[model samples]
Target: MVELQSGYKLKKLRSDRGGEYTSAEFLQFCEEIGLERQLTVAYSPQQNGVAERKNRTIVEMSKTMMKEKKLPYKFWGEAVNTAVYIRDRCPTKALEKVSPFEAFSGRKSGVKHLKVFGSICFCHVPNQLRSKLEDAAVKCIFVGYGKCEKGYRVYNLQTNKITTSRSVIFDENSLWDRDTQTVDSVTVQIRSEDTSRSSEEEHEETMIDIPSPPQVLAHAKCAAHIADTELYG
Candidate 1:
């Protein structure tokens, strides 16, 4: 499909001596299509430097992304897919600042719609899928871009499933690890209600306390020290 779209023909295929590529059916297909097969010697990766380096780059990128987000190992596939999607749009030195996607498609790739991978987001839920009082959006994690659709790939935490959707609101500043904030908010609300009742019960007591002048100065000094430490460190 890519070759057809790019108006290019596969003249030669260079790869290691893998069994799948060396099979009789494969050779016959290659011969029928007039494609030359170039096999590298055993244990000689240098002979296929381009492919080896590309594979290394992809794996490293995927590992870095997964590590940065602290994502589970099961999501490695998604990370690899995202890495390839980004790599296609990124400019290469050999291409003189032109991206691989642009070189192949004869058009520049647009990255305006790209979102931060592993960022916390809210995917819009269809009205028919929920009740009127239920939440309209469900929390999810941004994973990658859809290949055949104009949408983003997100992992629905609630459903333990991955889905592609265009109507997602990304909170790039947040991460999946911080999802506990929702529960913490509810806990805080409950504590606040208890505290309010206690305060109302204690309102009858005439007790007052105020910081001394020296205490106020000490608090100001502490704040200034913290600011200076943060600024310099």
Candidate 2:
């Protein structure tokens, strides 16, 4: 896709001697395409420093995003995808003043619609999917962007499914607590009296304005710093 968009013909392929890359079918395909294959020495990642560094950067960014949003590790794939999506729009030393997206597609990338990854969101439920008396939106977790569609990828908490929708409302300030009984599969039974008491307690806790510890605050600051520097540098 990149080569096609950039109107460039790929000449050489450099990669580690992974099984998938070393397969006979892959080698035949490359040979047919008249492309040279360059394989690094076994167990030597330094030979592929650029790719390794990029992978590490993506992983680190994904981890930071998941941690900041208090999202579960199960959403790591979504985080990684979102990180890559953001990275393509960010300026890089290799690309000089232009971003990877612009360099490849010949057009500047826009970030106006980007939202906080893993933030608590509400996706509008289509009228055909719900009755008039039912809620108009479903609670979800903002995951990433739709690759083939102009929409946001969200994790439906009620249905335990990932869905894409153009209509989504995000609450960037609030994160879903994973420890709470939010998943539909895990049902918690409570007595009528205990439910009322717990509701009151939850309200009181919500009203309390507790300050985050210095360590957490520092971590968040550091994450933001890294994001700005590595992504936009």
Candidate 3:
């Protein structure tokens, strides 16, 4: 509205048949402001060439970013936001070295806070929920910015959900190794089983064997009879 008021007297406003711009409230406001409302036909988005082209450009950029980073499909929103953010500040042929941000804001925008998308971030865990034995933070994937809050959208590893968190430490140089300890665990289990079986076999061989009770009684009686014979003689 400010841009419209600044540029012209707001004689007419044109848009597609989207629910956002074609609501009754918007029509009433336009009527009150002496502005003519022009809406394109239903299912005819091509009539709005500039908007459609911009949308296509942003979509392509987002796809390129996702492909380059090998990011998951669920992170499309983040990738798109990052693409738009970068595109806005980047110099374009039409702008002649002037960025969209500088053109809109009349000043250069700072790019210091930008970080690589899908990077590892450790978000601080709240003290109330963390146990003494647990770590002080949780690892997460940096997705994008928060739409409603003043923070970044981070996918929490523990919760398996996206959340806005301001407290995060980015590990840009780190990448997750999928099978770092896979072979070591299997080797350790095999060695432990082999050791256990060897010990069991050794114990079985060291067991002592004993004679039956009837053999012992016969030997004792024979010794007693010999003593009696000697005494009689």
Clash count (model 1, backbone only): 0
Error of 2 at 181 (Å): 2.8
Which stretch of 10 consecutive residues in model 3 shows the poorest summed lDDT?
181-190
How well is each residue in 1-233 modelled by candidate 1, as lDDT tens digits? Answer: 75788787878999999999999999999999899999999999999998899999999999988877767889899999999999999999999989999988888888899887877777767757775445656778899999899899998878889998998766664555545533111011111234446554633343333333233335544554565578778
What are the per-residue Cα lDDT tens digits for candidate 2 across 21-84?
A: 9999999999998999999999999999999999999999999999988788999999999999
Cα lDDT of candidate 3 equals: 0.67
For 37-144, candidate 3 gives per-residue lDDT tens digits of 788888898888777888899899888766654566777888888778878888877888899888766789777777777666667666587644456566677777
Best by TM-score: 2
Could you tell me how far off, in angstroms, the CA of residue 202 lies in candidate 3 after the best superposition? Answer: 62
**Which candidate's lDDT is highest?**
2
Candidate 2 vs candidate 3, TM-score winner: 2
Is candidate 1 or 3 superior in lDDT? 1
TM-score of each: 0.74, 0.76, 0.58
